[model samples]
Target chain A: TQLLEQSPQFLSIQEGENLTVYCNSSSVFSSLQWYRQEPGEGPVLLVTVVTGGEVKKLKRLTFQFGDARKDSSLHITAAQPGDTGLYLCAGPFTGGGNKLTFGTGTQLKVEL
Target chain B: DAGITQSPRHKVTETGTPVTLRCHQTENHRYMYWYRQDPGHGLRLIHYSYGVKDTDKGEVSDGYSVSRSKTEDFLLTLESATSSQTSVYFCAIRGIGDQPQHFGDGTRLSIL
Candidate 1:
């Protein structure tokens, strides 16, 4: 079975600080997606990267897919209290199925 | 929001009792999935349905069963609830094309 591991399981920082979260897996995937979930709410898709070394930006969040397609990262610039949440990375295996394996997750807390 | 709803946002029950969770979608997506989220395990797929009356077991389907009788509804059943099964459950839907899945708020189940 494929497993995705995320680094810095928990993070706390003051507002305006910058943070980066990483997701790694031994298995290569066809595509990778990033999501952010707030307390008491479901996760919302932030971006999907299909090609290796691809980068996508959504407002203050920047997502990068590794060149090997086995890892990905999310960077938040000038973090704010609104950016505090659980971030998860997920991807479908190379065989192209309707299923996706999700990363362990990184919880971020931005304080004022 | 892709029109997905999970019933009984929070449920508390005793061990050995039978439990059922319902997922309803208005998007008429062709795929629906059920996942359980734990502190360290991230989100593990429990079951998935490809179409009406067509379903498959996921990585963690030992104690869970799923049924899809309509295009917009999928039901997850726990034959005998166990304390280890206590976790937040999420329902997600995916369209036919190359689209990311959208999730519902989630159902929090506590088995005591």
Candidate 2:
């Protein structure tokens, strides 16, 4: 089973619309991160939430960490075509190394 | 962009052939990582290095090996490539403390 799972595997909406993607896991995490990947490029770190119940905002993007530190959500307001990409959430793969376990990505397409 | 460079952004190899992908970073980060991105699996860590000659296996390190001879270079090697190993590979680097990882453009590998 996947350590981290994301919902709404694929999302397509018109520009200016809003959308939210979720990442969940059964195991507790010390921290969770969000990444965005554009076509033909590697995933870029969007945000990281280290404290439970923490909420961070990056421009129009807001990231929230669950109170239990087992899940995360990324919400984008006024989505634009430039926001089209794959959204992924990750948690540190503890007990193994300093690696991370990423979720099944959510492919977001903001159409004009 | 983190000044990370992945060699041979694309490659195609035959089964049973040995292949190596290189990740070079100019940021002189202390930590480096190799990850593979698949269609539904998102990004899976293959290996990571904490410092020179200090490395550890990740969740999917069965057919992969890594080497960190210097602080700026990390190399991933597939002793005997298989079709199942074909995927886009990414390299990332992170500095000390609670810093986010910066990634390369990624290498699209195909094993025929």
Candidate 3:
């Protein structure tokens, strides 16, 4: 069973359009992270939310962690072709080890 | 990205052949991970190592094996490569248990 489930498996829109992707889970997490991956490359960490009801912004991208800590979201404002890629979410695990369980994944395509 | 590197960026091998993918890190991180990405399934954990000779299975460990004999190297091996095993594999590392992870470029493997 997938620990994290993502919505809108595939997304496509104009470069200037805005979009949001979600990650949901039934279990509580100590922390949650969002990553953006380009074709032929490994994913890069975009943001991490460790507190409930936390909101973080990186450039044009905004991330929100659910109050329950079981969900998260990534919103991209004025998307660009450069933002086209796969977005993934991973959850909080114990012991400080890199044992994060990841979500399904949302593939985004922003056209010019 | 960071100091991690995956060898044989791309490879095509026949079924039943043994294949190995290598992940090397120059920063001497204490934690390492391997994940496989598939459509809709996103990135699933396969195996991770907290230290040399200490490894554990992830959510998806079937048909795959991994080893970390040195602090700088982690290897994933397919005992009998199958078409079902074809996928882009990623390698990641975390400096400590609670730290965020860094990723390598990735390796594209195809079993024909």
Clash pairs (backbone) in predicted model 1: none
The TM-score of chain B in candidate 1 is: 0.98
- Candidate lDDT scores, in order, read 0.94, 0.92, 0.90
Native-referenced TM-scores of chain A, all candidate models:
0.96, 0.96, 0.94
The regions of model 1 sitting more than 4 angstroms off are none
* Candidate 3 per-residue C-alpha lDDT over A1-112 given as tens digits, one digit per residue, 9 for 90 to 100: 4378899889999989999999999888889999999888888999999999999999999999999988999999999999999999998555545588888899999999
Per-residue C-alpha lDDT of model 1 across residues A1-112, encoded as one tens digit per residue: 7889999999999999999999999998888999999999888988999999999999989999999999999999999999999999999855656998999999999999
- The numbered model that scores best in TM-score is 1
Q: What is the C-alpha interface RMSD of model 2?
A: 0.7
Determine which window of 10 residues in candidate 3 chain B has minimal summed lDDT: B94-103
TM-score of each: 0.98, 0.95, 0.95
Candidates' DockQ values?
0.88, 0.86, 0.88
Per-residue lDDT of model 2, residues B1-112, tens digit only: 5899999899998999999999999998999999999988999989999999999888889999999998999999999999999999999999888778888999999999
Candidate 3, after superposition: displacement of residue B109 in Å?
Answer: 0.8
Best by lDDT: 1
